[model samples]
Target: MTSGIHHFTGITADVQANVDFYAGFLGFRLVKQTGGYADAEQLHLIYGDGLGSPGSLLTFLVWEAAGRGRTGIGQVSELGLAVAPGSMGDWLTRALTVGIPHEGPSREFGEPVLRLKDPDGLIVKLVGAEMATPAPLNGAPTRLRGVTLLTDRASETAGFVSRFGYTNSGNTGMTQRMISDTDILDIREVSGFVPSVAGAGVPDHVAFRARDVDAVRSMRLSLEGHGPTEVHDRKYFLSLYVRDPVGILMEYATDGPGMTVDEAPGELGRTLFLPPHEADRAEDLRAMLPQFALPGEERFPVRELPFVHRFNRPKEPDGTTLVLLHGTGGNEADLMPIARRIAPRSSLLGVRGRATEEGTNRWFCRLDATTFDRADIRSEAEAFAAFVEGAVTGYGLSADRLVFLGYSNGANFLAAFIQLHPGLVRRATLLRGMQALENPPAADLSDTDVLVISGRNDPYARDGTELADALRARGARVDFRALLTGHELTGTDVTEASEWITRTLSLN
Candidate 1:
């Protein structure tokens, strides 16, 4: 069940036009054409390379005139295509040359991508998937990897992906990873559409790759679980559908090798690699096929970090940033999931704590493991504060409009850091706060959206009147809430926090 996305299907406006764009313009193929399998209410069209293997495959519902849907903070924003490595630069140039305006050549989740707007204004991305291999999963050498998009309801979408045999890799992004051979999928969470975008573009709808009926049933089994597997027999292929937490539609595609399996791996994009079952219509498809752009140069660049921070560039005109810090034992990867929470425009940069406590990320000394060492805390607080100042200034991220979020030890450090140096965080959320550092770190918290979320009864980062008074007195606009749980963050915890941040970030 830990397989990457077999495929995800979506409803679209134009059937032939959709096929033209994804196939002719983007170099995918029509793997299938038929009545909707799970829902006879519509038609389904499949496209991708090499039978839409692992990182390929896209399907649409051909809902040509469906009114625009509202995509919000917890919505799936875009779907990414893994293009030739080191080809973004070339593709950007080519796209511009061909009048296909592109926005990136920037880094996202530590990789390169070219962000563009499709005919429908849906966000489309072409990424330089630089990994050598994908994670293990149950499948046929993986025809589809994972569906990529943004979701306000992360766990919801994750649950949906789980149905298609996708397992979490613990890495997140606006476009995150599920597993197969290498990263099979890339899903992102887009807060909203880009300004001036005209139509529904990239993720007209997500589609997964599948092996055949057995694979389809396997995926259905994964999705249905203890109950009966949801199955539908369409004219073209058997399928199943479901709505994940965030409300995005997902589909389990079938085998028959589709278009990708039609041609040799090296010839996937050279010609129309249709499924063998459709050989009789090859000439007809070719005549109707649109010309396509070959894989191009990689435009984005990724550099290693010498210090504690990681910089993941966004593939958009507007910019948003997530300054990540790890708790004990949590390094750069700790706050990566949090970074994924900031979709569409935001990028992630993670910072590791300076000192180690019991081999964990500790900013200062510990007082018998649960208390604080006042002086050590103060020194570490100042140290992190200075780091933030330098980072904001040095990294061109001036404290304005910036979000600083942390957890456990990392949360303690961030709380201390912000208090000591007000204005470093425009809006901040502390997963589990610490009250031991009652020093009132700074005196300039005006203009900051202070969030202190806690488990109902947690010891560390425990909330009491002291925390509320301290943050409020420091001029922080605080939303301190204690949830039903203790110390640990449930998906519910993250869900609430995401909700709060969404509201806080949208204030006039």
Candidate 2:
């Protein structure tokens, strides 16, 4: 029977940073990039050895713009990677050069270990050990050494783990060591510890190896009274999940139908693959998911701009650019999918807001639920103007062909900008917008064209007409529409927005 860890999965908010650390810095090969098995909307990435070996695999569930999580009891708080013995100096030097947060060269459990924190603050311990196929001193980890589980009910968990072929080796302090055929398991018991909160940086589950379908079935049968999950066919493997006595998630996965089953070994991770069921929505999903450039590819450097921004250039460009500004609590990539559908051939530049309200992102400060901060609005608009000017020059984008698209709070900001700075924007679209200024000086907006869309059922729907009136009074061409909907966006918005853009841009 197969033993040891098949893989470990974790949650990460920043996919680019995660890939940079694991694949670029640590030298792991990106084995697969696919949509999540359970949710096709989010992405799932796998990193492993050169051959995409199961024992060396580490997978991640991408939750963009998610809040940070707490690592506490009932979680795998630390992931152990086996490295060649006496490689601490090399590892430390690499970490310093790459700006990876690290601690230790400290000895733990009679082995030299170097602790490095990933961008999301997940603990990765590189333990110096002599492996069967010894990894180079400055190379990718040979395989997973083990994982450190934080459990309050350690004795029960230990007994549960033994069914997967692990045997109690020894104990040091409150930590009991369990040895498997290919790796180690360290259960550190701490009473009265806080339970873990699920979000970014938390290890979701630890999967153990099963020889085949029969082995997985046998294991599932053994877990009858332990609340075992129904078997899930994950394309690459058949797996089942269960929560141990301490509430830590564990899985049993078949080793065959491996990583190379779908894609060739040489072409693995080169293309984004969706689950068979979601293949029909592949185009939409591609636009929604965050775009990333692997290491050594020609990529845009995220510069020190006035606003946090992200750029997505299509494979083929039609010489137009869309400047996207998201609503409150949203990030730079929030409106990517909508914008993509509106103008598939246009380049997208999504910018994050500088102001924050109640720990959530916003274009400008809010005095109250309905009141606006005038001074903050003016200041941010000026800064936003500067950011746009810089982006036009730096990104080699045409200033004359730029189109601004904003939603809600972002829409308000754009409306304010059009009033505060005349003729700055050539074309714009506002969704659920309002008149940002109480009273504004009339500016020459004859060179601009604006579209104002509002939901009739929305509380703020009346304000949309006010914004359209303000733009019209300033000599801008304004098209106003009220859809029969609520504050939340609907398919009607996409249809209207896309048709309007196609007509305005004359894109056949």
Mind giving the per-residue lDDT tens digits that candidate 1 earns over 1-508? 3244545455555444465456556656455554343333344566654444434456665543344554443334665666665777777776787677579788866678688765555666777764322322121122232345566555556656654556666665355566654455555555554422112443434545465778776666665543343565543445565546555555555644344334454444344344445566443333222222223434333223334554555446245567766677876545565456443356666676667767666656776766777778777776666776676666676455577777777777777777766666778887776665655545777877877877767765556446667788878888888787877667776677678767876783
lDDT for position 429 in model 2: 93
Q: Which stretches of candidate 1 lie over 4 Å from their true place?
A: 1-306, 313-318, 342-345
C-alpha TM-score for every candidate: 0.41, 0.87
Model 1, residue 247: C-alpha shift (Å): 52
**Model 2 lDDT per residue over 274-382, tens place:** 9999878787778767778799987766656788777778899888899999999987878887888888898899899989888889999989988999999999989
Question: What is the alpha-carbon lDDT of model 1 when measured against the actual structure?
Answer: 0.57
